[model samples]
Target: MSTQMIFDYVIVGAGSAGCVLANRLSAEEQNRVCLLEAGPKDRSPLISIPVGIGELLPGTRYNLHHHTTPQKHLNDRKLFWPRGRTLGGSSSINAMVYIRGNSDDYDAWEAEGNPGWGWKGLLPYFLMSEGNERGTDAHHSGYGPLSVSDLKWKTRSGHAFLRAAESLGHRPNNDFNGSQQNGVGFYQVTQRRGRRCSAATAYLHPVSSRSNLHVRTNSQVARIILRGEKATGVELLDGTKILANKEVILSAGAIQSPQLLMLSGIGDQDQLRKSGVTSQAHLPGVGKNLQDHLDIIQVVEASEAVSFSEALWPKLLTAMRLPELIFLNKGPLTSNVAEAGGFASSSLAGGNPDIQFHMTAVPTFQHGFNKRTCYGYSLHACALRPKSRGEITLDSTDPRKLPRIEPNYLSEPEDLQVMVEAFEMAQDILAQEELSRYKKKSLRPEQKLSDRESIIHYIRQHAESIYHPIGTCRMGSDELAVVDSELKVHGVDGLRVVDASIMPTLISGNTNAPVIAIAEKAAELIMQRSSRSFVKENRHTQEVE
Candidate 1:
């Protein structure tokens, strides 16, 4: 009673990269493409409004609600990791900051044996995928699928944050993705008008009418269908088979991509056997090299009513803003809460900014799950690149079971030291005269951090992830690398990973923009390869005729 379907290209996961692949690969009329998503359709109003991230992050409706295994270094705390499950994936639930990490971050990837991934090589792809409101430039594009625009409404505290940083000798940078990345400024967001412009909205939705492409929602893949060393397609948990006539692309993010590989008998032999699954590829690096940005927030009470606390506004006032948000697309709802932030170099940095900041005009605790009743602002500082590495491993052979995620934060001594420096620098910026007018008292640390020991103690107690995780299925020439520079799975033919998981190392800033760019390059590579194959097949046919 199992069903069977086939396509030229089968993309697993309708996420940021999957949506782009579906759009590009299906552009050729002859090529049939199928995109499978395990979650529901992204039809919620909360997903469209920019500020709805507050409601999205706290629940499981649109989020995967994944959590990490206990960290041995950070007092054995299990951190919450929420990933978007709907059509847009994390792009639907994210804050929509349009930051491309430091240019050196990509160059370092090339230095680590990944050839065309350097900033010089990838910049074109970034430009191709962007549609900036600021119009065209050497570094930006005004005619791409993804919309990048300035927030229509920014909180008053956001303006004070930038001025405070500038007062502390940091230059004011209008564009973080410009000539230099060192300074304070408002962040550009992935929005069009006042609504969120996720990869689904930008790339997939417009092309959904194409006859060559088929999108399947609520289709949770159990495992890839492998014939010997090659991936043929995938099987759903409900006993249905989806066959890929050409190739199978995994864009299921960092955590699940490798899990799918392992479930399909293509991972470490020992681990597969332990998990009660047979091994086919014996690739030891299947789920290794996990990296994420560890962030710590400094919350201070504001003397005035500048924060986004609901307690400050009357119920009638909140209800009246609905028409402004819907009809005019202008109101407080337009604000992408993590509105203004900047990059800074810690004392331990080597030229490029080692720390990134996210200044929110709201006092958010535990990823905004705990609602606050007071007025306060928060300053988030995270290490751009961390030495600490963690992993994702299978808990059971069943795909329904979630993977074991151990971020292993602050395991490296240097990582802890860098965090200490980042904390001190954030404290300094918050104490600046421009922000002193609004500051009333510190909230999180609850005491003055006078020295290194106190700062270290505070970091371990308060630090959490800013939700940028990568490198689970890294791309490199090393033996531990799961994918090559071309993004093909090393030992498996017709199988590739084209998401943030393939990043050889973590980038310097927010990851969403970089992930979209990665997908853009991947589509081009796939098409070129397909074109060459078509030419060869036609030549053989003509010769035989």
Candidate 2:
């Protein structure tokens, strides 16, 4: 009375990591791979446009617009967290800046017991995943699937912000992904010509014709079907069961990956029982160690008419610029909102930058939901590594329900201290004479925020998330680690979580580039194991013959 289809590999969530897995795993016709996505096909015109991040952030059609529960810190304010729910995941809906964090960040991961994850261990994967427009070098490769290019159209305000940063003693480095990350400059984007090159665009779309790989869109996974402690397959929201002959990979990201584990009765025993899920495995770290970069924006009204806000008001300019974008791939529409940004170190970090600055040529407020009708610029400062940790727990037994996200931002006193220091440091750069030519007035907080306490007070009221959430299912060897060094779920066979969730600690920059590299490594690991099995089987056959 029941029907089911089996796959060599069943990948949950056709997101940034899932798409990569689908592409690599199904390269061999012998291996049948299935990818399931909860969202619809990524056909939105806004998704392809680099500047359309403004249009996509507040909308829910292609975005899982999530909000964290009210934080106990920061006057108990609930922060907005929008993740891309469509094919490419957050990569499709993000600012598209391709930043592969600092080398030390990865080195710290190796120091934390995750071997083959340090920068030295994973540089080949990063190079293999990138198709840098700048061509091949010691640090980059030009012949990969993902395209990385410089901005075709740079704004005057964005350039001025860089000059201002330089005047404040920060050296200008063209490539943030190069030898050192502590510098100021325009960011290279995950774009080709001028359009967004998300993970789906780079890996999945090109391989759509492959018969061996099956991509199912708009199919939400309820939970992984476990046989004892082994993951056999996944059950869909519509009650259809799909079996995995080889393995089941959970690439549902920092939030959902852990939620799925908990739903499948693989999390803390007490928590699973409360959620009406029978406990099968007791992994206490299923949804713990939640981390994210908390960002605060400082807006300055421009003296001249050089902001993206102008094009929005005239309306006709936007219409006229469409052809330029469509044909020439050159216009305001080509701008990846956070056009120019770089890394810097405050007193918080010993040497490397612990804070990052995003200088956008538009006055953005409330995560691009409410744009002020004025020509202005914004300086976004985010603490690179906040000591604060949070958790994701089940809200109910229903898999359709969203999980409870509690980032507990600024819970640690040092986090608040770094935020205040970063805020003050940003003010110093904004006050430089290089930016004096375009500076008009400070829009958000008054220009008189000189003292430390007042700046902290302002950050508490106005700060919001930069949407870089990670570490919910951390990969390490500790007792609290959900995944081991190989990214396999502890105590569960044939199960693994490969996404931003598996990060032991949050990276120092935008998470997209690093996540793609993570998937590349995962693909290698899976293929190596499969190859060894084939060799062993052949030996047995020859011996028996």
Candidate 3:
């Protein structure tokens, strides 16, 4: 808390990756670490409940809630993007779907310039942060703080889904993450005893009592203060600066990572001049290549006696079930809504799967936010691998101004072509004999699914992001690349970014787990280098002695 004292590392943004880096880097007896968060504490009960994540948004406490400059692809409508500002970051407020994505997703990263990020190199960190509900091994870890548990009483729809897949000639796999990831099954969730498990609970809670570590909340970071080419420390909103003893690592995430970089005069030279910020680096790719998963859900009418609509009637009676859920930890209350999902290849040429299925127990609005209602099962399909690219630009030199995010959703014609396959796949799923008993004739039958023109029209009207935005500060060997594989800024020293923003390409599943894994691996890399430096200093001292 004192400016006079120097910390080994000054970590900006106490989000998912920041918390993990703080815990791992400050574990020793003498090392000092400072973790700063722009938002308040995570004391609200709404953030802890899986279903309660809905309320976490629309308020200042949990959601930072920044809006993008109107998307040209989406009819000039500015998109509302919500990132958690609390201790755990988006991990606290997101729908707790825990996925490592497919192993091929990481292999594809190696195919790009980043070699050490492949599945073989990254799985150890992934396992290190996981306390699997099943157990421990090469695939999962049991000693970690984050709890990955089974959902409450596999829903009736989940059971129906499994049977439906088998009837459709699709094989059912017990564990999708075990031997492979290409099958229909229930999703693994981020939960502990039926309660949501945020990264703060996983990595920050235990270490908060440590004297060497100082966790500062509501500390807004404006820019990375630099002396020559090195990131000396960070400047606060009050114009006060905290200089670091060793390094300044940014975990501000995808949107804010590039925003802070551009604000600090470390972006495309021309763009920086236009935004009235002095250029610290001429890296053109600092905010380029932005990618996100765009999903469009198809709602249907269900046959009687099967829909959750009839089962959830009598709202007052359903509320009584809360006690049973809390006490016995067995009920619908523990459901993450999106219980079942699948991954498939969109290309008939037999490339790796590029499309994903998200079967929700409820309805989805234009954006992710929606009112609670008893309705038929919902299915969402998003292209896992998109050919389109976008950018994150600074609106102005002001630190308070939100960044301009142009995701360029469906920019490439291929992006829309992939969505068409996704729709056809969803229909194929419903056509299965197992689901026939539950299928009521199309509620949106007249809603248009016939011609290509009709499907594209529906897509333009309905598609929205799946909340996994990444690659704004992409790491690679390309000239446009902002950082190298080591996570260091291309033209600066003593500064590194360890968050989803540095991903070379988007992973195939939920971004939370991969984001946490990035932090875990980055922490080890940083500490190991520090330890080697200490050893070298000791050896030199021995020679002088």
Candidate closest to the true structure, highest lDDT: 1
List where candidate 2 sits over 4 angstroms from the true fold: 310-313, 529-545
Query: What's the ranking of the predictions by lDDT, best on top?
Result: 1, 2, 3
Give the C-alpha miss distance for residue 405 in model 2, angstroms. Answer: 0.9
lDDT score, residue 84, model 1?
88
Q: Candidate 3 lDDT, tens digit per residue, 29-88?
A: 588899999989888867776766545755667788877666666667666788999899
**What lDDT does candidate 3 reach at residue 537?**
41
Clashing pairs in 3: none
Q: Worst 10-residue stretch by lDDT in candidate 1?
A: 530-539
Model 2 clash tally?
A: 0
Q: Judged by lDDT against the true structure, how good is candidate 3? A: 0.78
- Model 3 C-alpha RMSD to native: 5.5
lDDT of 2: 0.88
Q: Which stretches of candidate 3 lie over 4 Å from their true place?
A: 1-5, 57-60, 301-318, 368-372, 431-448, 529-545
Model with the higher lDDT, candidate 1 or 3: 1
Alpha carbon lDDT of each predicted model: 0.89, 0.88, 0.78
Cα error of candidate 1 at position 166, Å: 1.0
- Alpha-carbon error at 484 in model 1, in Å? 1.0
